[model samples]
Target: MTESDLIAALEDAGVHVVFLPYPKPGSYWHAHQLIVIDARLSSRWQRCTLAHEAVHAWYGHEGPCAPETEAWVDERAAGLLVTEQAYARAEWLHGPDVHAIADELDVTPWVIEAFQRTLRRVA
Candidate 1:
């Protein structure tokens, strides 16, 4: 889904999204049902961050997540943002370069990495 679609989904789920000058790329406050994205990030980063935070909200995380939770969130968010078909097509076109694949898919390298992890788990 697009950034707008993600925002709409969050709103529909009673979560609010806001852009602020945050130190981190994005954060989800479960208690407040709010997602805050660092206003300074580029659009690509913002979109990726939004997806990551949305997964946290979907899972109803209360505070800071543990490493395992963060990993799961990354995988889930990567799945939400990039489909397997698209990833495969990007890889076919761009080879195994993470940056090239990410550029082709219009997602962050982190998302690409997470997607790779997901693919590994499935395989």
Candidate 2:
């Protein structure tokens, strides 16, 4: 879904989203059902951060997340943001360059990496 769509879905699910100058790109507070995204980030990063934080909220995560939890979140966010068909098309057009593929996919390289990791796990 698009960023606006995701935001609307989160709001519909009782999660409030706000933009502020945060140190991190985004954070999800499960206790408050809130998501705070750093307004200073670029639009693409904001989209990425929103997807990541949304997954945390979807899973009802609380407190600091462990490494495994973070990885799982990234995978889930990547799945939500980037489809396998689109990723394949981008990779075919741009070869193996993460940045180029991400640019084509309209996502961050981190999302591309996470998607790649998910692909590996499935393979």
Candidate 3:
């Protein structure tokens, strides 16, 4: 989905989406204040970052926590972005070509792989 699409979704849920167009030093998303997106990134990468950040907002991750909590948040965001049905369908259709699915989803290939692995362990 487009950034506007994601923004609209979040706004509908009562979250504000703000765009900060500058050099993408690193993707950062804060839950407490608002969703600040790095506009320098491609729309695809923006979508990935948006989903990841939104996961943080959804889970109410306010501050730094235990290492396990951080890991869970990151992996959970990846899984939520890729999603269970999407993951299963991608697995069935792509047959180990995760980068292809990541290309389609606008997420990093490694994120997809990790998300798939996380789901495997979870299930």
What TM-score do all the candidates reach, one by one? 0.96, 0.97, 0.69
Question: What are the per-residue Cα lDDT tens digits for candidate 2 across 1-123?
Answer: 799999999999999999999999999889899999999998999999999999999899998999999999999999999999999999999999999999999899999999999999999
2 versus 3: better lDDT goes to: 2
Query: What is the RMSD of candidate 1?
Result: 0.8
Better of 2 and 3 by TM-score: 2
On the 0 to 100 scale, the lDDT of residue 29 in model 3 is 45
Per-residue error (Å), model 2, residue 101: 0.5
lDDT per residue as tens, model 1, 1-123:
799999999999999999989998988889899999999999999999999999999889888879998989999999989999999999999999999999999999999999999999899
Runs in model 1 with CA error above 4 Å? none
Pairwise lDDT winner, candidates 1 and 2: 2
lDDT value for model 3: 0.68
How well does candidate 3 match the true structure in TM-score terms?
0.69
Ranking by lDDT: 2, 1, 3
lDDT of 3 by residue, 1-123 (tens): 455766777777677776687565123345344777777877667777777666667766665567777566658668656777877777787788888878766687756866876977978
Best by lDDT: 2
**TM-score leaderboard ranking:** 2, 1, 3
lDDT of each: 0.94, 0.95, 0.68
lDDT of 1 at 115: 96
